[model samples]
Target: MAGWEQTRRRHRLVHDVAGDFARNGPRALAAWRPAIETEFGGLDDLLRDVQRRLHTAAEARLDALIEAPPADLDTSVAAVLDEVAEIYPDLRRLLDAHASHPAVAEGTVRFHRSVRTATGVDLTRTRSDRSRYEEKGPVRDRKPVFFARLRPVCGWLH
Candidate 1:
């Protein structure tokens, strides 16, 4: 086909679509509703997949830290826990939003369990205690309470 002919055809197609939307008004959007709904429905699944990947990576990182004998265990632990602190709020929000989802709940439980195993502190308990104090909602500044608790046992954190 000639280039000009193709351009003309595209212009006609665009005009046709514009005419349909003009005639149909709001009804033009009706065709898109199901696809939009499908996308919205898939968002939960996408979130779940992201959560799972994050948990897996965190768990592996923690395990590596636990297995190695770092010269400065406190600093190493602090570094990893700092990463955890960063992700905790988002993870908590996902948990709250999908509390009914068994997979999300299970992944959260597993992540917390891994943390407890790596650090002596049980974050779930810390979170529960902290939650009681914060009337406004999710605490903005989350300092991993594990450092204070781990200090006595390791004697490395000053």
Candidate 2:
């Protein structure tokens, strides 16, 4: 399969495994892991690649933002918000899939904080609204629904 297709399949597998694990528990998950590792490779390696891709994409986005400054702070913040909104779901999926894994769970926490600090956007939030960027105070309190939804998966992993 093509690289993108393979990545897409891997992502689907992770999502499926996570869903099954949620319903069936660790016993079912344990059986699934061998096939998961066989087809998609190790979870650790997959997560590393996912993080690397996200970081590279973030850097490129930041570079673009720097190269062409927005009209004002609102515009700049909005740009970052939009970028994070686009990226967070995939990252959240990878994190959710391997939340039980020690290294990956720690990485997820770090990634969440770093993204929030850098972009002033709460990645944990499930929904994105362009209007939210209009207000300064509300943005800070934004809940990470995406992270919340995946919390159980991590709990199960442990």
Candidate 3:
């Protein structure tokens, strides 16, 4: 399967698990509170670190690119844009690494089981079994789009 497809599946699984926990309400939250807080806090810290490093790296590269004015300004601009685009794969790999860590995986499975037991819902069930709880069709679709570039970030800037 494509990388985006795998990423989408992972996100959907997270959403479904969250929904299950939500349905179970406060008690479920209480049961998994520590794990949730720890995991989310860890993720936050990781993101902050990444953001700081990215800022430093981008600044240094941009400074160098500015200092050395290439003959083709458009090509230089494109190179910078391409370099920024390349960061997404690195970020994805970092996330994938964190998700696949043994402790994280084990914790996730344990939490998922707890939520499933609390809610009495089995996400692993076949479509026919799931159909009882989940309505079919696009309206009921929970799968998120991989990437929907519907508009420019700041149209006003243009």
TM-score of each: 0.38, 0.41, 0.28
User: In terms of TM-score, how similar is model 1 to the real structure?
Assistant: 0.38
User: Best to worst by lDDT, what's the order?
Assistant: 2, 1, 3
Candidate closest to the true structure, highest TM-score:
2
**Residue ranges of candidate 2 with Cα displaced over 4 Å:** 46-100, 119-158
Q: Put down candidate 1 lDDT per residue, 19-99, tens digits, no spaces.
A: 444456536435634543444344345346546645554555566667764776555544554454343444434334455
Candidate ranking (TM-score, best to worst): 2, 1, 3
Residues 73-123 of candidate 2: C-alpha lDDT, one tens digit per residue: 334534454444343444544444556677666665686677567555565
In model 2, what is the error at residue 140, expressed in angstroms? 23
Q: Could you tell which candidate, 1 or 3, scores higher by TM-score?
A: 1
Query: Which prediction has more favorable TM-score, 2 or 3?
Result: 2
Native-structure RMSD, model 3? 20.7
lDDT of 3 at 41: 48
Mark the 10 consecutive residues where model 1 has the least summed lDDT: 149-158
The number of the candidate with the highest lDDT is: 2
Candidate lDDT scores, in order, read: 0.48, 0.52, 0.39
Give the alpha carbon lDDT tens digit for every residue of 24-141 in model 3.
5435445644544454444444333333333343344444445665676444433432343233334323423355555445543563454345334343442321132223222223
C-alpha root-mean-square deviation, each candidate: 16.3, 10.7, 20.7
